[model samples]
Target chain A: TQLLEQSPQFLSIQEGENLTVYCNSSSVFSSLQWYRQEPGEGPVLLVTVVTGGEVKKLKRLTFQFGDARKDSSLHITAAQPGDTGLYLCAGGPHKTGANSKLTFGKGITLSVRP
Target chain B: EAGVAQSPRYKIIEKRQSVAFWCNPISGHATLYWYQQILGQGPKLLIQFQNNGVVDDSQLPKDRFSAERLKGVDSTLKIQPAKLEDSAVYLCASNRLRDARSEYFGPGTRLTVL
Candidate 1:
């Protein structure tokens, strides 16, 4: 019941290309978050990966977390068009809700065409 | 500083009528959330609050859905009767219940149900 699978879903680059997005899960997450929404707004937090081979960056956007924490990724260097939008990957507050309960991933819109 | 806050950015209703949505968080953020976006997916934690009460709502839809925050800051979400898949896009988020994580969202409330 704890699922969070994301992949291509949709992408359209064409300007200063470069991309990567994924988030898989079999279960096991203490933290992991990454969001970016635009049309109408809502998601914004762009990074939050806890331990597990952690790696975070924001300038060029690059985040990775997965040493066993399940999975996570997002790399978008150089992209443009304001970096398009829609890109999410959430994991937990799990172990039974409240510790941080979150479990979303079914997104990856990206467009970036200049 | 001020971020999470929602209202009637849009609504169309007709299915069965009845609708309500609102939220205001980010002042102190004692943890609060309510999501249900469904256009492209991603974002679906029906309920969660840690200051006014409920720690999780399982996934909401408590028959027809209902929510509140009492004093945990501000919140409300009702949907009795509506169903056309209940349209969707009703988000509100916050965090800081001791930094259990880090969430902050808003600017949602699309609902269309017709």
Candidate 2:
């Protein structure tokens, strides 16, 4: 079974529209991170939330960690064509090391049309 | 201030052949990671390294896959007797030993096993 589940798998929205993607898990995590990947490129870090119930904003993107630390969400305000990419959520185990492994979700593909 | 570097952005080989990909993480970063990303899926951790010592490699397919991070800076991942199912993008990422929240990634090497 996947440690993390993301939905919807694919989404297409017009520019200026708003959308939210979710990542859920049955396991609690020490931290959660969001990444955005474009075609032919590796994923780039968008934000990291370590505290439960923490919310972080990066420009037009907002990320929230669930109170129980088992889920997270990414909300985009005023999506743009440049935001078209694969959105991935990765959860770090509750281990006590900087080298703890991260488990990733299947990812959500976002297509922002101009 | 350079990001992680990966070589031979693309590779194609027949099944049962061998292939290798290389990566150089950001300078001063002591933690390195290798991930495999299949089409339509998020990247999965294959191995992680702290300095020249391996911190975690539980998910690596030992019978067919092997990786080494020499001098704790550059790393190489190899697949022997590659199979068609091994076709995917191999990504390299790294971060500071003190900061696990900001991992930087390289432009992955896309491998196609025919």
TM-score of chain A of each: 0.33, 0.95
* Model 1 stretches astray by more than 4 angstroms: A1-14, A17-51, A55-62, A66-74, A80-84, A94-111, B1-35, B38-42, B47-80, B83-86, B89-111
Backbone steric clashes in candidate 1, count: 2
lDDT by residue for model 1 over A42-94, one digit each (tens)? 99888888789899999888898999889988988889999898888888754
Model 1: how far residue A104 lies from native, Å: 5.1
* Candidate 1 docking DockQ: 0.28
Which residue pairs clash in candidate 2? none
lDDT of 1 by residue, B1-114 (tens): 678878988899899889999899889888898989899899888988888998779889899989988988999999999999979788898888644655888889899998
Q: DockQ (Cα-based) per candidate?
A: 0.28, 0.70
- lDDT by residue (B14-80, candidate 2, tens digit) is 9999999999999999999999999999998899898998888989999999999878889999999
Chain B structural similarity (TM-score) per candidate = 0.33, 0.97
